[model samples]
Target: MAYKITDECISCGACEADCPVGAISAGDDKYVIDADTCIDCGACAGTCPVGAPVEA
Candidate 1:
């Protein structure tokens, strides 16, 4: 499964830069992860300071 950005995201932009596949992006209030583009690499999850990224 691909990773998802939870509501806990602080929009810090760390995950965006950490996403190797460029799946993470800025949403209206938080960051969102593109499930189709995500490679399940967990890079975004690891980079998230608030632990917003989780496996979908």
Candidate 2:
């Protein structure tokens, strides 16, 4: 499953920087993930300080 950024995100760039496949990007309110590009490696989840990234 792909990882989705929940509202818990603090709009930090940590997940974006840690996403190995470049699937994460900055959104208007938070970070968004490209499901198609997500490798489901949980890299974003691991790096997110707020634990906003969740499996979807």
Candidate 3:
């Protein structure tokens, strides 16, 4: 499954650089994960500071 950014995201942009697949991007309220591009590697979840990424 791909990872999703929850409301807990603080927009710190930490996960953005760590995403090897370039699946994450900044959204209006928070960072968002492109499910189609995500490789389900859990990289985003691992890189997030606030545990904002969840398996979707």
Candidate 4:
């Protein structure tokens, strides 16, 4: 499964830059993951300060 950014995301851009597959991007209120592009590597989750990235 791909990782999804929760409402807890603070729009810090940490996850976006850390995503190895370039699946994460800035959204209206938070970061969002491109399910089709995500590789499930957990890089975003590992780098997120608020633990916003979670398995979907």
Q: Give all candidates' CA lDDT scores.
A: 0.90, 0.93, 0.94, 0.92
lDDT (tens digit, per residue) of candidate 2 on 3-47: 999999999799999888899999999889999999999988888
Query: What is the C-alpha lDDT profile of model 4 across 1-56, one tens digit per residue?
Result: 99899999999999999888888888898889999999999999899899999999
Residue 34's C-alpha lDDT in candidate 3?
94
Number of the candidate with higher lDDT, 2 or 3: 3
> Looking at candidate 1, what is the lDDT of residue 53?
94
Which lDDT tens digits does candidate 3 get at residues 1-56?
78899999999999999999899999999999999999999988888889999998
lDDT comparing candidate 3 with the true structure: 0.94
TM-scores, all candidates, are 0.95, 0.96, 0.96, 0.96
Give candidate 4's total backbone clashes: 0
Question: Model 4 off-target regions past 4 Å?
Answer: none
Q: 31, model 4: CA deviation in Å?
A: 0.7
| lDDT-based ranking | 3, 2, 4, 1
**lDDT for 16 (candidate 1):** 96
- Per-residue lDDT of model 1, residues 1-56, tens digit only: 99988889888999999888898889999999888999999998887889999998
Per-prediction tally of clashes = 0, 0, 0, 0
Quote model 4's TM-score. 0.96
- Candidate 2's C-alpha runs over 4 A off are none
Instruction: Report the lDDT of model 1 for residue 15.
Output: 96
- Span of 10 residues, lowest total lDDT, candidate 2: 42-51
Q: Is candidate 3 or candidate 4 better by lDDT?
A: 3
lDDT of 1 at 54: 96
